[model samples]
Target chain A: MHDFFFYLFSALTVLTALLVVLCPNAVNSAVFMIVSFVGTAALFLLLDAFFLAILQVLVYAGAVMVLFLFIIMLLDVERSSRVRPDVVTVVAASVAVLLLAFGMGYLFLTGHDATAATMAAVPQVPGGANPMEYATASRAFGYGLFTKYMLPFQVAGFLLLVAMVGVIVLSKRLTGSNEAGKPSAQEIRESEVSQS
Target chain B: MNHSELLTQLSEQYVSTNQWCALWPEIALALLAVLVLLIDLFAGRLRARAVPFAAIAGQVVIFAVLLGKLGTCDPADSGLLFSGMILPTTLSEVMRLFFLLASILVCWLGMLYLRKQDLPRMEFYCLTLIVTAALMLLGQSSNFVMLFVALETVTIGFYILVSYGRNSIFSLEGGLKYLVLGGTSTAILLFGIVLLYGAAGDPSLPVHSGDSLNFLALEQFLAANPNNVLAKVGMVLVLCGVCFKIGAVPFQIWIPDVYQGAPTPVTAFLAVSSKAAGFIVLINLVTGPFGPMASLTVPLLSAITVVTILFGNLTALGQRNVKRVMGLSGIAHAGYLLLGIVALIQGVELAAWAVIFYLFTYLFGSFTVFGVMSHLAGPDDENQEVDHYVNLARRQPFLAGVLAIGLGSLAGIPPLAGFIGKVFLFVVAFQANLYLLLGVAILGVVISIYYYFGWMREAFFQEQTWPEGKEEQLAPIKVCLPHKVAMAALAIITVLLGIYQGGFGGGF
Candidate 1:
């Protein structure tokens, strides 16, 4: 029964991904992507990576998608006219499809038959197992993140910060009087060029 | 020895349990970051521009320390550090040292660039160290779990830094593209990891011979299950993600656009340190985790290298903006680095040397080019067009000369560092029987020259400057001693290094 659900959800995820990629409307594609993400969460649960599944739902399907939606809504981008397939995109897509077919063939031909015994090894750390402690699998993730994964986590945060700062500096038009007491970005740029 | 005893035994094999030689420099960098951040926080009350300079000075000292460590450190002393989330191999040590040096230089340039723009300083330098530290961890990671975190850290740093000059719509778009694509790639990599983990019998064991996610364990696993279809599939998927990070052919989509769109200093950082780190991680994976599976992995790598070289060089020819050209040329350089990686897979000692030399040379060449770009970037990044440099030799003679040398080196012209790096790679490729890749590389060099010389020609030979855009607010050119010093140092270093591939040593 679990296997049935697993295959069903996985198939749904994959098919929805195709829709996300191939769909004409960007907004529709985004909405479909959220569905695909949710389906993937279900598939993760079947595989017993339960924490990851909840993360998939909460972070990706919930938070990240919402952020993406915000951008889409905020931008209110006009519906893009139908894009004629570029040679590169078309070629890439075809190659991907071919590779996918080969992957499927190889899997079916060489893969072992799935069984329940094989699936039980990495048991899911049950949700609500200690929900009050950290609110989600994020607690263990945090522990691992700070300890073993501290370096990368910190770097990722900095990268985001830089990007944020960079974007702001790039967009803001300096008022003539803004630099009355401060050095203007223009002055800074000229001096930088002169120095180099 | 059992688990505890095994660690003890492993410790016994090394000089000292406390003496993880490869890890010292990284420890220094991390400590330095904390120190710099703390110092910066208190800097406002103390002095003007203290924090940024302190951060830069800290990085400079750390770079020197890492170099000192690299000079004396031996590869045989390589071992897992901190339970092997990070490892210290000759390859990673070299990579880390080079990364530190590059970060220092980029941060210095970034400071000047941002100062020119009148942006905040303390946060800028502090973030650079944080990002550099993240990259070091990324290069040293042996466990995929750590690997993901480290990679994410680097990605996040790049994402934020890329958009640091946020007022530009282009910079914002670059960051957005990077974020979305980066997240997708990370997800794909995780999926690949999960699949591999599921396939392994003892999932808790490190990946080599054991069932865990360790590089050495994975290497052993790969050996035992050479024909394990699942493992192979997982490997390919994981490789795909790493390739994206390196900005190689198949996943090279966002690179040129991002490079063109990002602030010049950040672009320099992205092209050099980020590209070098990608090579470092690739070296680790190829040498340790998938060492035995070279046969299958090598050809795929070679093909990508070939196409990437051809594609990058050819596309670069059409670019009108200098930054865009730099981006495309950077991609082509990635192709060259990939050739070095392909050479290592041949199991030849000479080939390994070639890879190292090529990486160091590539690093210098990239620095030279970007340093010159940093010199020419007009206020508000207005001097972006290729035509902006028309008759530059008539105006800013020194900047023009440095630009020439930088571009010449990038094009692999003789007597430049790029040429030496290329020759070393060609010899290795010949030995490795990668004739097709060698030819593609050679062809890339030829194509590269056209664009490089084309820019040089415009800069030097053109008698008149192209009229500025009607909307352009041309900032009068003012050359500073510090900028001149950066260009001269880089230009001289590139030439000197090209003369002999030995003395300046670093890179993964």
Candidate 2:
């Protein structure tokens, strides 16, 4: 049952990820990307990494996708008019893709034996703990995060704060007499529209 | 163990590992950043006058404290704190001081920059402080998680800084380009970390580690499995991500455009502090977990050095835009530094010191040039071209003289700090038997002289040919007292370091 679920989610992830890239509309691509993230979260759930799975959904699928959608709407990017690739670009891209596909195929087929052997040999968790229970417990994550990973966790908070400040600095409009006579977003949009 | 016992045990372990005192400088810097924002929030009218002074004064105090403690804060005594998350060594201590100094200079530059622009003032200083704190942490991090988080903070702060001049289209364009490329590099770096974690944590592997993200454990794992394919790929990917930060070739496509578009202060910050942070991380990795894999790293870095040197110099040759010229020449400097890294990997321990010394010289030289650039740049910050510098010597000899010393140092001219720095690196590289790389680097330096001199010539030698009626545009730029003092200090430091290597040179 676990193997079956893994395969199902893996296929879902790969298919949705391809659709994300292939979709012409930005909004459609973002939606597909969220689905792909969900598929990845499901796969993580199968591995008993429940905390990671939840974060994958919450952060990537929920928060990040919303941001992507907001940007697409704000920019009002038209459905990407497909620019046809030149012969050189087409040939180069195809050759690169084909080589990657070949390399991946070769690695998967041959590398599986070594990896499988390693996995089979290491069924028991180190320090005599039950891997499933330890991994599934949120308390375990809390302990690790607060103890060993405390510095990084605090630094991550600063990272988010910096990101927030950055967004405001980049997007906020100038006010007062120091506005420097620059055009407003609305004005620029109108001007662009008229020009088009 | 039962739940109560387990809880007690965890708390005990946390108490043992959480050494908060060791992180006082970082904590103080963060608090200073918050204080700057609060001042901005409350002071309102006074903020413009108050914040930059507060930010600079606060950092100067911290810098003094850190400098005083430098002798006592030995890494051997402290070992690893926060459960091996941080390992503060002599290099990291120096870097902490280095970052503090860089932040102070950047705030000074930002003050000059903001006075002329219509941007928000307080957040620039706030973010600069926060990023400096993060960079200090980055140099001290002994674990992958700590390094990545700190690096991301620095990069994100830069994203805002690079685009702080939102009124300028070029600034926004540069910020977007940096955001996309930086995010991609972060992903690549994270992927590499994950790969190493997976490979090293496999219990079937020799000397397998449960905490594979820690440098010591990963080093043990790599030493045991020298031929591990997964680990090798992961190491290469990680290096590639760092290369992007240092603006080495193949990862340097973003440098020219971004450098051209960013505000002068921000471009200076990126070129000096950001690049220095990247080198510190690279040096740590090569000397720590990736030490055992020197066989792979030495050759790989040599090839990159060759290309980076030649490519950076050749591309920089035709650039008329001064910032673009700086950007491309900065790439070549990265190549020279890469040569030092290669030597370190080849067992020349002194190469590490050489790299740090070079970075110090780079800071002095680059900031001097940037200081001049900021003073001369008009309201349209991005349009600073080489031609704008004509007749600069005749009009403002002080600025012209500073520019000449800065450029001369960067070109590795004798009797400047940069020349000494290059000599140290080359000596170390020679000790490592990197004769071919040494040749390419010298050739690259010779090529770089053409452009560096080209800028200097414009300032000192080029005849003024202002279009009729536009002669007023070329009037003498009023160099403010603070800027003059700062530029003079940097120039004096360059000259002093060149003449007397002192402790920095003698120690290595």
Candidate 3:
């Protein structure tokens, strides 16, 4: 049953992730990305990381997808796919495929014996139950985050704060369109045309 | 046994007041950032002077406190701090001083830079302080979680800083590129961490009980499972992300555009502090958890060094823009530094020292050049192209000399700090028997002279040309006192460090 579920979620994740890149429209791509993230969340559930699964759904599939959709809407890109498969794209794709093959080969060469041995070694509780196993993964996560990971947690907070300031500072316009400030790109192009 | 009891027990075990002192410098920097903001909010008419002055004064205090902390540090209490999150080793202490010095110089340069540019000086200083604190934290982070969080903090601050000149199309374009690339690298790094976690996360080791992300636990895990394919892949991916941060080849497409477009002082900060932070983290990773994997990483680093040095110098040969030249040369310097990393992997004890000493000299040389650039390029005009530097010596002799010294040191001329740093790195490479790498690095240095002197020639050898009716526009450039002071100070540091082979070079 575990193997079946793993294969199912992994297949769905790969399919939707491919769709995200191949979709013609930006909005469609974003929607497909949401689906891919949902597939990822399901995989996380299979790993017994219930909290991370929820986070994958809430933060990535919901919030991050909405943000992507908002940016796509703001830009109002055309459905027309003008992406020509140039030499650079082709080379990059080929290299990526080669790397993936190499990775898979390495995995096969190493085999799953190590993973099986590790699984066999996971300790059981005194009550003859796996209480400290996946059943308590979410609790263990919280415990780890609050204690061992506190410094990084604080640093992550600062990162978000800096990102907020960055968005505001970069997007804010200090000067109006007709001030004695630096010329806009349009104005500069126009002046160059006139000069030519 | 239950959740609340577990939480309580964890808190009792981990939380302590003594450990907080190890974090004093970071806390002080955070407070100083907020204080600068408050001063900006209330200073009203005095906002300009008050903001920068407050920042400089705060930096001085922080520096003193950090120095005191450094002096008082017991060598015996030298392992991981804060539950294995940060490791305040002697190396971190030394690197923190470098970060602080970079901050102090940046604030001074920013003050003079703001005189000509119409920028909100407050936010600039605030971001500088915050980034400095983040960099200081990065130096001590010994865990993957700490490394990622601190790395993101520094990069996010830089995103805004690189595009602070919102009015300029080039600036916004540069920032957009940086954001996209920086975000991609962060994602790659996180994925690598996840993979490593999956490969070695046993939940049995004490550190692993929380999260097997601690460097000590990770090292043990990797040692036990040396042939793990997933762990090797993750290590390579993480190294790639770090390579991007350091502006190495193949991951360095963003450096030139971003460096050229950023405000001059910011360019200096990125060229020095940001790059130094990247190296410090690289040292921590390569020397700490990644040490046992040297057989794999050495060849990888050697390849990166060869390509990075060759690419940085080859492309720089054709660049007209002085900032772009510096950007490419920065990549070349990263290659030279990576040479040290490769040597470290080969078990040369002084390789780490070579990397830090090189960065130390780079800070002075790069800043002196950038300081001169900021002073020359007023808010009204960006003196970007090397052509604009024609007859600079005749017009502004002081600025010209500063640039010459900066470029000369960068080119690794003898009797300069950069040359000393290069010699040490070469010596380490020789010790490691990295003769091929040494040859490539030497060739890179030889190739760098053409362009470094190309700018010097433009500045000192060529005569200024005035268009038929535009001669009036070429009046002698009047540099402000503050600008002069900063330039002179940086130039002095650069030359003095070159001449005096101080205790700084006696490996930490």
Candidate 4:
């Protein structure tokens, strides 16, 4: 059952990811990426990474994807008539296959029996970090995050605040523009004045 | 007992609740960040210059606390926290200390940078703390989940800094490019992590309760299956994502634009702190979570190093934009650091020593060059072109000399810190039998000379005219408090590191 779910979601993820990369229109690609993200979130769940799965939904799907869509809609990006960056596409495709081959080779040589034995030892929770026996992801991760790795957790929060400020500051004001489609800041101001 | 019953018992018995000692640095940084923000919010009531002074004071306190924590963490430790998701040991301690120090310098320069720019100074200081805290976490992360979160935290801060000069379209463009590329890379990183999770997930539970994002499990996982194709694929994708952070080739697309478009002080921070954090995280992942999987990691980093070296130097050759040139050169330097990572695969080697020393030495050198650039670039930093430096030698020989020394070190000229750093890495690579990569690295350095000197030619020898009435464009040869202090500190240290390559226990 686990294998079935893994394979199912893995295939869906790859397919959607492909659509995201191959799709011509920005909106379509963005939508495809959202699907891909959802598939990954589900796959994380199937893998018993409940915390990670929730984070995927909360962070990637909820916050980040919405932002991606927002930018896409704001820009109203259409498919360029240019031929889809053919060289980059081909190179990326080839590299993907090569990496896939390498992963397969690494997997084939792994120690299965040793891993199985380790798995058997997990449920006993001899040292208390064996998440295998735990029913909820939050309990184990929370304990770890708050106690042992609390510093990193807090630091991660700090990083988020900085990123938020940085984005707002960087994207808000533009002094000069040359050789491009002009932003509508002037028009908006004019509309505001007319309204006034 | 039920599974929950068993877990509850073990949690009390083995997972001691006394791990706060391991969390000192992070706590300090977090408190510092909040304190700065609070101070900034109420500076009018408190006092004048509260923002920079208070921020500096807070940072100093955090720095001391972080150092004290580092002094306490045992190197031989294999301790685990939060269900083995975070590990802070010898490696993390070393990285944490370096990051803290770098952030201090960045904050200092950032404060000096904002005085005349008229950008909001308080928010800038506040963001500095926030990013510093993020970088500290990035250094200690032992799991994939934390890795993603920490990486995003820093990148987001950078995006804001890049575009902080909202009035300029160039800054916006840089921010936009970073956002688009960063978002794409993050997606790729997530995909990679999920793939690996799928390949090795536990089967006993309905949802795999033990995805094992922690390094210990990952190490066990890789050594157990050196040939796991799916896992290997995941690792490569992860590396690609990290590679983007470090400005390595292929992922080098955004660095030039972002660096050029960013404010000078911000560019200095980006080049030093952001790039250093990326390497620290890379070292952690390669040596920790991905440690078992050398068959893939070694070759990947080696190849990346080679290509990164060649590409960065070659592209920088033609760049007229000073910032863009530095951006490309930054890529090349990342390649040099990757060499240290590749060497660690054989055994726990001291190759990382060279990388650390180089990062430390380059911080001063790069900061000096960018500091001068910022001063020249003016309030909005409009002039980024190489020709802007024509006759700098004639006008500001002292500043020109300092730039020369910085560029010289970057080009790996002998009797300079960069040369010693290169030699240390080269020896390590040689010992590891990566002769081909060493040869490529040497070639890359040789190529770098042309580009580094190309700028020098404009700055020192050229006779190009400035736009009408821009005589004060060049800084004075006489050193000021800030510039002199920064230059003296970096120069003295760099010369010391280069001349006495043996002792001082620095490259740990």
lDDT (10s digit) by residue, model 4, range B92-194: 6766777777777777777656654645566777777777767777777677777777777887887787876554566767877998999999888888888
- What TM-score does chain A of each model score against the native chain A? 0.64, 0.75, 0.74, 0.64
Model 3 Cα lDDT, one tens digit per residue, A1-196: 9999999989999998999878888888888888889999999888777788999999999998899889888877779657789999999999999988987787668644444443445655444545546344666677666776677787787788777767666544444344464455556445334532
lDDT of 2 at B190: 90
Candidate No. with top lDDT? 2
Scored by TM against the true chain B, the candidates give: 0.90, 0.98, 0.95, 0.90
- Model 4 misplacement above 4 A: A1-156, A167-196, B1-18, B45-48, B64-73, B77-83, B202-211, B463-479, B501-508
Best by TM-score: 2
Per residue, candidate 2 scores C-alpha lDDT tens digits across B457-507 of 888888767767675745568987878999999999999989998787775
State the lDDT at B95 in candidate 4: 69
Provide the interface RMSD of candidate 2 in angstroms, 1 decimal place. 4.1
Residue lDDT tens for model 3, B269-352 = 998998898889889888888888887898888999999999999999999988889999999999999999899889997888
Cα-based lDDT at residue B9, candidate 1: 46
Off by over 4 Å in 3: A99-118, A124-143, A175-196, B1-3, B68-71, B75-80, B202-210, B378-383, B465-471, B505-508
TM-score: which is higher, 2 or 3? 2
> Docking quality tier of candidate 4?
acceptable
Residue B426 shift from truth in candidate 2, angstroms: 0.7
Cα lDDT, all candidates: 0.73, 0.89, 0.82, 0.73
True contacts kept of 3: 0.39
**What's the ranking of the predictions by DockQ, best on top?**
2, 3, 4, 1
